[model samples]
Target: MANPKELDPAESPQAFYGAELRRLRLAKGLSQEALGALVFCSGAYIGQMESATRQPQKDLSERLDVALGTDGHFTRLYPMVTRSRFADYFTAVRELQEMARTIYEYDPVLVPGLLQTAEYARAVFRAFDPLRLAVETDELVSMRMERAHILHSPTRPRYWVVLDEAVIRRVTGNARVMHGQLAHLAQLVRSNRIVLQVLPFSAGGHPLMQGSLTLMTFVDAPPVAYGEGPYRGQLIDDPAYVENCRWAYDLVRSAALSHEASLALIEAAAEDYASEQD
Candidate 1:
């Protein structure tokens, strides 16, 4: 069998954290499975953390400290592994998304970031942080808008989105904002830059009722799945885990309306919002 690949700790903060975790675990004569059991997570998750494919959560890091007798080493380094503007768990996903050749998404609520108009995005950030200063909101919206560049890149990924009808039905930023948001989505579809389908309320409960999911495929690396949860997110790179997410996404996609039908629905929503504003 091939030798286990060596990790270069200096490559990144995440790499360093993973390397330290592995070293501490081995010194204690505990396998990944053992450590995971002590921490209430899966061995595969621990393996992903060691390989630097996943970031450790604050809670998990604390548990690792207690279990490995590392005296808070992992916890101290956790903040360094995260990006200031993004959640710690979402940093890896954002990096992978930048390199992906194709992106498939299922959003149960709110417009996906890549498709949000500036006004709509600003509204979202403000609502999420009503107490934030205006400058802070601007900075947040700028960061989100910067991510939209992926949609305009020359080597842009093939984008496909399946939206639950509630995403469009909800009035996020009043009638004007909803109208612009839906119109923007329709424009992307008309430009043939994206493939979109709406999973109508009539479809009833479905495979992705849990939350949002993004499956990204790369030209030179294995696929990954990023799942969103309340106040946190998860990035899955394990082959088997990614495949399972892909299967679920396929089910959700199948349950959505046909492309033509979905487009019509979006256009009608936009018109309704516009009329409401008038």
Candidate 2:
């Protein structure tokens, strides 16, 4: 039999959300039987909702609201069919990000999370104020690595990242760690699953000097531009706004190093760091 964990190439988001809800409910110690007792639905009915084989309607949310006794928190079943599960702020962007056929990110300060090496991540995190304890920092690094796992999935998104020269020279980790990361990036380029464009220090003036953004496009939905600062972010779904970001990124890509040149430059940078370590 086929693996239950695999994507159908055309699976609906509703199915994915259902699977998550069921998992979350069970994890929270709610028995299907007990949950059913409160919601006026049989165990089988709850099972159906959990599998995402069943659509969650507004009426069902209203009914579950009264039955679950948690106001609308747990009972407010998300309509994954036409809306994002994320808050109005982030929306279902993460879900969509996972589902995208292609993703493009602009990193003006540091490497985008998807391309970061684990050790490199730790150094970056340490740069944040009020350093976390070692164990806590390790867990945070693990979480970021896990998030990068989506890129390794069979139906993973194709990543195209434009990195600022500042990021390549940020000196996040020890020289050894930085060398390893640059070498790893060159390896990713060889795999051809990723495209890297390096914006040199020479490109002194550009439109994106404002900040960074990650743009994603899915097979079944409109493109989105996610813009963020040090602590704030916004999902731009408006056609005009998204389109504008696209063109701006194009200019940046054009001004950066070409593919072959970028790979050579990365290798050179790695060796330079390796010399520092030695």
Top lDDT prediction, candidate number? 1
Which 10-residue window in model 2 sums to the lowest lDDT?
A: 1-10
**Candidate 1: segments with Cα more than 4 A from true spot:** 1-13, 17-87
* TM-score of each predicted structure versus truth: 0.73, 0.68
lDDT for 42 in candidate 2 is 59
Backbone clashes in model 2, listed as residue pairs: 86-91
Give the Å shift of residue 53 in candidate 2.
19
State the lDDT of candidate 1 residue by residue for 120-178, as single tens digits.
99898888888999998888788888988888889899999999999999889899999
| Model 2 TM-score (2 dp) | 0.68
lDDT per residue as tens, model 2, 164-253: 998778787788988988988898889876899899999888879989988887654457788877655666556678899999999999
